[model samples]
Target: MFWWFERSGEHLRLEVLQLAADKYELRVIDADGTARVETFANADDLAKRQTQLQHALSSQGWTGPHGWVM
Candidate 1:
């Protein structure tokens, strides 16, 4: 799983990639996906988010693909 965040006036963007087993990598990208800042973190704190994503694919009356998008 991954996500990006952008602000109104900044040329910088943040890309977060979820690795496996509660690990994740973050990359600060330019508007064109050029890397500016890169780092990794133990994403165990994101347990709830992970569960929510799974539910979105399979539960609460939803259905479709499973797991991360990319």
Candidate 2:
């Protein structure tokens, strides 16, 4: 899945990926091209972290998670 957040005309991207049957990754790429990657062992953990991330982003004034599954 892919998501986008925008702030002051800058865009940031988030990607959810399954690296293996039991391994998943959440990647956040900033508008400046810096990337932060986190791995999870299951969907539940990924979901929780995604929520936390969204809240943090929102607090930072990012205006969306406009997204789609890939």
Candidate 3:
């Protein structure tokens, strides 16, 4: 599953995808999903504000290896 959010005043969009394996893919897409800035990380720990947002997701709300807990 994926949720889409448009940045307040930009043409960019943030998409949060929930995968079957408990990981996640975040894409900063343009007006259209065709063009995007992509990043991959663990879905569990996905709320940290690290310098590298991509890395932050690797351990943010991590609970287990099979599914989301938070």
lDDT of 1 by residue, 1-70 (tens): 4443334433433345767666666554555667754334566544544455445534433333223345
Model 2, C-alpha of 49: deviation from truth (Å): 0.4
Pick out the ten consecutive residues of candidate 2 with the lowest summed lDDT: 61-70
Residues 1-70, model 3: lDDT tens digits: 2333333333433455666475665554544546554444665454442224434333443221122223
Cand. 3 Cα-lDDT: 0.42
Candidate 2 lDDT over 1-70, as tens digits, reads 9999999999999999999999999999999999999999999999999999999999999999998987
Model 1 spans with C-alpha error above 4 angstroms: 1-10, 31-33, 44-70
Which rank order by TM-score, best down to worst?
Answer: 2, 3, 1
RMSD of 3: 9.9
Query: Which parts of model 3 have CA positions greater than 4 angstroms off?
Result: 1-10, 31-34, 37-41, 49-70
At residue 5, candidate 3 shows an lDDT of 31
Model 1 residue 65 distance off true place after TM-score fit, in angstroms: 28
Q: Each prediction's TM-score against the native?
A: 0.36, 0.97, 0.37
Winner by lDDT:
2
For model 3, the run of ten residues with the poorest summed lDDT: 61-70
Error of 1 at 30 (Å): 2.9
